[model samples]
Target: ERPNNSRFSSCSVGNISAVLDAVRDGRKRDCLKEDAGAFCGNKIVEVGEECDCG
Candidate 1:
């Protein structure tokens, strides 16, 4: 089970696909610049990402 503070609280046994679809939609709306992919591991939360602990 997920903790109350989890960002994926909407996830459940039968509705996981819906949750993934929502996430994909959100990502589409929040699309980042082409260069954003190269900075994913720099340990910084950039425009298109929620967190980067690397």
Candidate 2:
């Protein structure tokens, strides 16, 4: 379950599920690319990423 905070308050279960499904199905691959110096904070938790607060 998501925390009851303003950051995730607007995020619905359906929306999060859809995103997770897309990631699992490789549909979000194109959007997961990161530059040489960019790793986290893009909002999409890619492989090896621990967390993304931004």
* Best by the TM-score measure: 2
Q: Please report the TM-score between candidate 2 and the true structure.
A: 0.37
For candidate 1, write residues 6-30 as lDDT tens digits: 5544446447775567678784444
TM-score of each: 0.28, 0.37
Q: How many angstroms is residue 17 displaced in model 1 relative to the true structure, after the best TM-score fit?
A: 48
True-vs-predicted CA distance for residue 52, candidate 1, Å:
0.3
Model 2 worst lDDT run, 10 consecutive residues: 1-10
lDDT of 2 by residue, 1-54 (tens): 357554543458678778889988988866455677546776767778778776
Clashing pairs in 1: none
Q: How many clashes show up per model?
A: 0, 0
| Candidate 1: residue 14 Cα off by (Å) | 53
Question: In angstroms, how far off is 27's CA in candidate 2?
Answer: 0.8
Poorest 10 consecutive residues by lDDT, candidate 1 = 27-36
Clashes of 2: 0
